[model samples]
Target: MEKIVISESNYQIRKARIVRTKKLTPLETLFEIVLDGDRSLDHEPGQFIMVSLFGIGEAPISVASSPTMRDSFEICVRAVGRVTKALHALDAGDEIGIRGPYGKGFPIRIFEGNDLLIVAGGLGIAPLRSLIQYVLDNRRDFGKAHLLLGCKTPQDILFADELDQWRRRMDVQSEYIVDRAEQDWTGPVGLITTLIPGVHLEPERTFGVVVGPPVMYKFVIKELLAKNIPEHQIILSFERHMKCGMGKCGRCQIQNIYTCQDGPVFRYSAVKHMSEAF
Candidate 1:
């Protein structure tokens, strides 16, 4: 249980070991990481960390696990680029560099007494999974919770086993849809928006949280707004190229706001008009 001590600099990296790994899909992998010294990554549900792999450079990855799970954190990665490509080559017991649980996360405190509608599309479920787990783990603190998930195909859905568990839970309600269905799949087939209308929720008491691709947000937000949910009650997490988790890089700027500093998660009312936000 060696403690991982970081230097005074905000950019200083902490050593983390991959305790376990699971190949979630052909391109995506889930890594359960334990920071040195068995430290807890006390991060809000939607915050992200900068992951470094020696000379390959670093990239921002969200904390996929809930903060309620104190021992270790999880991050889901897609092998799409240089840093992530290098990341995918590693396995359990591999040590890597980590910094931050940076950015403002989901407004769980504000949502404590409200019903929640979680909408996730494609790989967007990565970060939303944390919020979903947090709400479920603290079910008594919140009202009804509904998760509406959409992905490209049956094989592309993220957390199949865990989703099954969520579906069976009496405390949570979940519906999954895929763009293209497979022979073995029996669930609904359509856009994620289709499922939103059928959800029984009191707009005044419900908060809608959405995360997904740029295109997905357009339609999903439209549906959420149409459902009579207020603008400020709808939360959105934008997936940006957050090169530096510290917000100095300016790469993740949405107009005057730095997504790494001010957001990654923001109320839809605050960013809806910002062209670059969605």
Candidate 2:
């Protein structure tokens, strides 16, 4: 076992295809990546993998594809930093290093047979997309599932083709809002929180999962708590500047919790009180 571990430290990267790529917005790009080898990514929903650009840098990216798809995985990348900028430059059939399917994912077992209220804002939907696709794939494991997605503008939407498919599905009740709308936009317009009140849910049976920017959490969480969802049942995924995907790096530490190891995913009650966790 130790010999296997030592040999893999060189971080062998498989040559994968871009397979598909979409220019969601001027600043964001979504890449559908697949491994060239026979092995699948084998990731849980909400779990993130570190995408390495070799000489440039490594960035922690959530697996945006569902575990259902045997052929490939997806990652929605926002060109906000150096590593991401490098990632955005590449396209189909590109070679990039990959290290982990690290951090804990959503608690799929606990959510079994329970209603789910999934809330995603801005780039936050990048991570939640994995879990949503999973739940939709295995719809039997969960009860009524609702997705609430919000972005800066109509053009900012990620996974547009998938979003339309979700909107058309009878099994999944999905809605989206843009903070600001253009003349052509016809969907709901407002902060994501505005759409929360309209979503009727049994607070006791429903698990509220929210993933969004730092500012979005403070307000959205307050809405979920007010809806009577238990603090522990309200789940969230946090973001930070990460270096090493392992906990050894202090870059992603939030108080005593390491975002890379202890989470990127956390229950609200466990971390709501922590400063800078927003």
Candidate 3:
């Protein structure tokens, strides 16, 4: 018998170190990580990586930083489960394993030269931040950009300072709303869908990209369709428990389609019929 040896496994984990950390919310902490050897994650916006802790296991996290950030990348973790809770305990100087910047990302080439309508809800902003930052970094390549963000409350908002900076930019039109508010709250109070109607864009020239809780999708897509955007131009990132970054795991599967491989990102036209894909 002939011997066939494999040099590497697709599941290989690269050593990465956390260089900085910030507590975004009571539930969420942001980690700034750099791969060993000065390597860039080199990931596209809306893609995700599988982060591992030797004893605790791994979880798929969206790359919160844009590809423009070549030196390091970020992942905003909400300490909701075993792996994430353990991840939150680590601070700067801790080491972890990184498996992938896997799955298809937002199609940047298709978005070029088009007006953009970016809608994010709650934790969805983490992944969408990548696309938002990319568009802003290469601002000239895109047309009018509108950002509509919604959260449970003011304090729950991620990247508050950065969101303010984006709002102040003349090139980007930004609006925010919360589902509920305190006595001091003065901004609009409602579901994120409330903010969509007033946005003015040439639907034919606009691309609508959305990411958020599963419940947010149907309603948001309704509003985007009402705005006359084509189904194919309306993009979505579906949240799934992706056990493996590769398609073989079957954990992130939606029927025959694998969210880890076929998506995390998909055009509405491609997934509208897939009942499992919210």
Candidate 4:
């Protein structure tokens, strides 16, 4: 019988070193990493990579930086579980294993020349940050851009400094809200959906990109639909718990579709029929 040899590249783990670390919040820490030989992650906005530690297991983390930043890439980790807690404990100069920048990412070409309505809730901003940064870098390629951000509290907001920079940009329209207000918080107090109603855009030329918790989708999508945006123009990211980045694991399967391979980013019209997608 002939021997069938499998390629190791599919499961190859590259060694990467952390160059910097920033404590975004008490629970979330951001790591700036560079691969061996200064290799760029070269990932698209909304794509994720599997981060591994020797003794501890690996977890899938979305690429938080846009591909425009060629020097290095970033991943924002929240200390929620065993692997993430361990990841949070590491500091700059630490070494880790990196497998891939897997899954489908946001389609930038299709969104070109169209106004963008980007909505992020809580930790969902991590992935959407990639797309936002890309748009900012290539601002001339797109039309009007709007950012609607929601966090639990003032302390829970990630990238505070960058968020302020975004708000200051005359080219971008940015609005924020918090579920509960702290003494220092002077912004609107309510759900993210509340900001959607006041946004002014041409539905035919607007594209709505949303990333957030499962519960946020139902309400947010409803609001987007009410804005008269076409179903095909509404895009979403479903960050499911994918055990293996490849399609073989079946961990991120939504019915027959693999969220890890087929999605994590999907159009509203494409997955609207799938009850589990939202």
- Backbone clash count for every predicted candidate, in the order shown: 0, 0, 0, 0
lDDT of each: 0.89, 0.85, 0.92, 0.91
State each model's C-alpha RMSD to the native. 4.1, 3.2, 4.0, 3.7
Candidate 1's clash total is 0
Question: For this target, which candidate reaches the highest lDDT against the unseen true structure?
Answer: 3
Residue 91 in model 2: shift from native, Å? 1.7
Writing each residue's lDDT as its tens digit, candidate 3 over 153-215 gives: 999999999999999999999999999999898899999999998998999999999999999
Q: What is the per-residue lDDT of model 2 for residues 111-205, given as tens digits with 9 covering 90 to 100?
A: 99999999999888888888888898888989999999999899888878989999999999999999998799988899999988888899999
lDDT per residue for candidate 1 within 1-278, as digits (tens), equals: 11223336447789999999999999999999999999888889998999999988999999999999999999999999899999999999999999987888898999999999999988889999999889888889999899999999999999999999999999899999999887898998888999988999999999999998899888888988999999999999887887876667788877888888787888989888897675
lDDT of 2 at 197: 83
Model 4 residue 201 distance off true place after TM-score fit, in angstroms: 0.5
Q: How does candidate 4 fare on TM-score?
A: 0.96
Ranking by TM-score: 3, 4, 1, 2
- Which has the better TM-score: candidate 2, or candidate 3? 3
TM-score for each predicted model, relative to the true structure: 0.95, 0.93, 0.96, 0.96
Model 4 ranges off by over 4 Å? 1-10
